[model samples]
Target chain A: MGTNPVPNKKLAIFTATGCRACENAILDIHYQVSSLARCADIAFWPYMLGSEVRDLEKQESIDVCFFAGAIRTSSDREAALKLREKSRIMVACGACAAFGGMPGLVNISQWSVVSGQSQRTMDNKQQTNEEEKPELPPLESRVLGLPQIVKVDYLVPGCPPTQNFLWAAIQSLVCNGQSPARLSFAASRLPEAIAQAITSGILPPKGSIFAGEKAVCASCSRVKEEKRFETYKRPYQAYEELGRCLLEQGLVCQGITTQEGCGGLCTAMGQPCRGCFGKAEAIFDPGAKMVSAISSTFDSNDAQEIAALVDDIVDLVGTFYRYTLPTQCALFSTPSKD
Target chain B: MSDFEPKIIAFLCTWCAYVAADTAGIARYKQKPNVRVIRVLCSGMVDPNYVLKAFASGADAVLVGGCHPGDCHYISGNIKAMRRAPLLRKLLEEMGVENGRFRLEWIAASDAPQYAEIINQMSEEVRSLGPFSPSTIK
Candidate 1:
């Protein structure tokens, strides 16, 4: 993606508050990046290939912009609004941008999280006598999804989006929705759904999330057996065979409400669904739906038993609303026309 | 605070709390008449989003009243509510909502006087707590 940052149809990427895994996800598209690059230019990605602050300050309109972080600080909001102003199509690319992702957990408390980290940094600095790092810009009280701050045309929903699906999205956008005559070779290298999506060449309407409409369970290869919620298993604890569904084994799988389209990537690897792909279509509150789904599935109806079933759920908010919490303000805050 | 009347949105379970409120009305009980009730088939029917929506849409507070733990009409709907309430409360608190702004209680069908008393108490408590600004929600 960075090898030749020549100017063509302008494409820009902006990071506000994220781990930069999404940038790595784009890089993981490997050789396909060059083919996509042939169609467009990398206008202002400051992450890998360096760009001066003045270079971004003088930036003009862009064809497509991928914003990959939650709007945390005033600077982040300014960047988002600026990106919205300059881009023809703005995509929230990754869970942080689309639904607040890991960074949103800091909203648990405005002061404590940031202060705790800064305090730790102080301790580390004292130990090493290291040169002072640049201080971060002050955070807004809440983390916000891209859609909340400004209108977003599309969302690539994932902690870091699935590589093949991301490729398909870029290629489709580059081709202007028509399947390229030269896709069979690349399609053969992708997953079936991504291959079909690229080959079929139908552009979804604006504001569509680039993920499956159904829950991640639909794409998971694991067999669903009995839902015996006897105990909640922590990540460090031993788990059952990879063949069986992780949710049925009481591992806090969020597939029931999480949108698929990562091709069940984590679940396929025996990890439970963390709902990084935002709420599946038609679901309102991802956490509440998950609570209802799992609470009802417990083997025993006894109060103490149910509590026991949930006792191991250390971070209920993180487990269920890890990616969707920032989106919750839109879920119910506005009065519905009931 | 004397003139501050709280706007409460109650999601009452049809089997228990809804009927209790009806009986409170028929029995001529003295209650603070502030709550706008949306009767659900079961307490479990009220997703956390509904409570958030109620507060977001200008309500001062939200109360979710249902059957007692073992008395659920759906055998286990109230049990599910039990599991969700505390965590939902924590989530709301994280979003800058005060914990007292949400109340989860059990109201039996025959507990008309009790229902009236609870309503009066919640209304008075919220009135003292002052109006909740919806702008702080986001």
Candidate 2:
């Protein structure tokens, strides 16, 4: 009797305009690396596999592509288009690909001046062989999240999504979550319901975020109390209250409006949540949501008092839209075909 | 720029600003026909996304008209809008939205003249700014 055989899925790891930490996160999956290796064949990971001849133009169609990083350079955009053409399932891994991570701050600052500064700061270049280093391509006008450049099937959000959430996404995509999701840091640490759903062996709907739907505040292990803000301070200024909600301490925690799944990693370590996870459910703009959500909790509703209260927020854009400006900003998003 | 009739997207709160618009229209108050109004339940309900979307889709100006502070029927809805407007304005400006392109003002239900005057003022401001060219932002 002949049995139906399933071919292994071809997975490509593509990266551009990022810190390359997402690639490391994938490798840091440590104990489960073999499980992932067994589930899919590495088709074209130029960064790690050292397999040159990137001419993906001739390779058989790739099954899934883990695309990490923003499209910042002409070469990056070109490669993204080529990868899109060759791959069937495109997963935007990490915040840069999904929402233009910290690097996206260049979108606000003068990108040209920034690039100019970079050239002046490359003092260590003489140590390396002059011809060995690749010429850095001129950056495009502004950084754009993956969706801005091409169609994206799914987004795994994070600065570089936590090792757990990312591994979950890979497992879900390749194994249909048939394998147990529970591990020391991967699934066992997640809220029970989320862990259950991820490990249920069902492929989530397309366009789904491979993270918790709840706001980061839900997972934040901080003592909750009524919040009535009178003053806002930078994290450095707050020296006393260490364990209470950062927002209550006026440290500008975005967890109240941010979608969770990193397990409030930064907030857990006495730092405010930077909202690397994009918008929470039903939030159209995290900035607008944060303003409304935070302002309502203010102790004083008086106009003068409130105006002063708002002045304490040092960088309004960096606080809420830190990760999402590229896709949400009208500047780049307008010309898209979507 | 003299003949330019800029497109303004106005998010008017239903209780006050929307009522003022209706009153101005019924009373035959002279107001520029440039503004395209989107009425919301409360000024606070107009998410910054709405304003950002308006600009994204080619709105020349965005006017968020709400009730005067303490005049909100829902108690403190305008207060919330008050809280968000300045920060949203700063954020949008940082993203390259010109000043005059984004505004939030209190218009009472009975202030039809003020509503008409405000529209004319906004139209003039936007006209002077020469239509929102997002290119300058980059």
Candidate 3:
């Protein structure tokens, strides 16, 4: 391990929605907390400290800012923009920030359908002239990842990145004077200082992913044989046999198309991959690519028969674009008319 | 409206449909000139992205041509393509694309007249449906 030339660099941790896990991830540093504290100053952390948005805005700059959550609303976008302005290196710190997470599945339905009920309820309450309430910020029609709104230097992708990977990122930044390679998912989107490294060929290509080059199936520990499925099975419908590939058994495991990360943890635990790590290299639409791959594996050739086989999938959009709907090409819809 | 000419993207499988297209040309079969044929190795090789991209980039309709069952050069490539067609159509429908904008047909190498007929029918159908405005999608 190397040492930082300038210690006590300022750090910020910004949370939006689904960020409770990242809050815990900070303490997950555990015994190494002291080591982290010794090198960098926690200049701002809204959840753990008294610092507010105004306080963060007051700072001239921060060495690193870890933003966790999907940009579902205007406020989230505001925070992301503010943090981007203040931080030298911005990291999208969780799945919600990296790939839109579970919230992105809302992309399947029309934007009005997803948010209309709440808007109607709010309108009804306002009409009653009850106690004064703070005006709510408008929501974006689509749930977007941090990178969709602002330049993100790194992405620590997981529902909450594993504690070990989190520590390695901090250690590499503080101890080695460089960001961890595993955390450099969107290095091309970095600001001047970091982008220069890629432009000058010191770092890897601009859009190089920090994780393993292969798809999750390459790292999966299950026994995979020739794949041919007569029917699709949802996880809740059956007991999956141990050590057998979930996809080979007709469960829609996304391992074959998902970028490798999280050590194939969900697959190891007998559940299919939800594709939170996003598409593998050379893949543009994670959902469509998986759909194509899965479709190719079906046993039948008759269009009616294949449609019947596919009809078994309860929610096509939810199943395929579980975490990546916002960025999926086929799901792109025009903005709401309202 | 009467002069509406649809812009069609026809993905022709090299072993069967491409040959049929050439035969149609040589035989002087009268077919709609609106269809732009892109020769691919096999219909199974047509990724959904190509179709989606074609629609996104302003194609009025996409026509995928493959070998009839048991006629595929790569053994079961057309079978794989058959399995994929329905799913791709379903996905397109979910995205709010109008029905009949995508068609999958099997054209044998010797069936030049049939190939010309299908293209003419598809061109007429897509023309009636009008231009595909994917404005709802970004």
Top candidate (lDDT): 2
Which candidate number has the best TM-score?
A: 3
Please list all clashing residue pairs in model 2, or write none if there are none: none
The lDDT per prediction is 0.76, 0.79, 0.76
Query: Per-prediction RMSD in angstroms?
Result: 4.9, 4.2, 5.2
What tens-digit string does per-residue lDDT give for candidate 3 at A63-161?
Answer: 888888888888888888898899987877777887777787666567778679768878887888678854767888778877788877777676667
Query: In DockQ, how does model 2 score against the reference complex?
Result: 0.48
Cα error, residue A25 of model 3, in Å, equals: 3.0
**lDDT tens digits, residue span A13-63, model 1:** 778888888888988989977766777778888896675334766777788
Residue pairs in clash, model 1 = none
Pairs with backbone N, CA or C atoms under 3 Å apart (clashes), candidate 3: A334-B136
TM-score of each: 0.83, 0.84, 0.86
By summed lDDT, the worst window of 10 consecutive residues in model 2 chain A runs over A177-186
Interface RMSD of each: 3.9, 2.4, 2.5
Candidates sorted on TM-score, descending: 3, 2, 1
By lDDT rank, best first, the candidates go 2, 3, 1
Across all candidates, the chain A TM-score values are 0.83, 0.83, 0.83
Instruction: Supply DockQ values for each candidate.
Output: 0.32, 0.48, 0.46
lDDT (Cα, tens digit) per residue for candidate 2, span A1-338? 13414457788997888988888888888888887877688988988886543668768798889999988888888888988899988989999998877777777777777778767545356346566665677678888888878888888998878987888777766545334533323445454554455555444556777778789998999988887778888888875666798888777788987888888899888898888888787676677667666776677767788778767776777777788777654453434324
Cα deviation of A282, candidate 3, in Å: 2.5
- The reply for model 2, stretches above 4 Å from the true place, is A1-9, A53-61, A109-134, A175-203, A239-243, A330-338, B39-44, B133-138
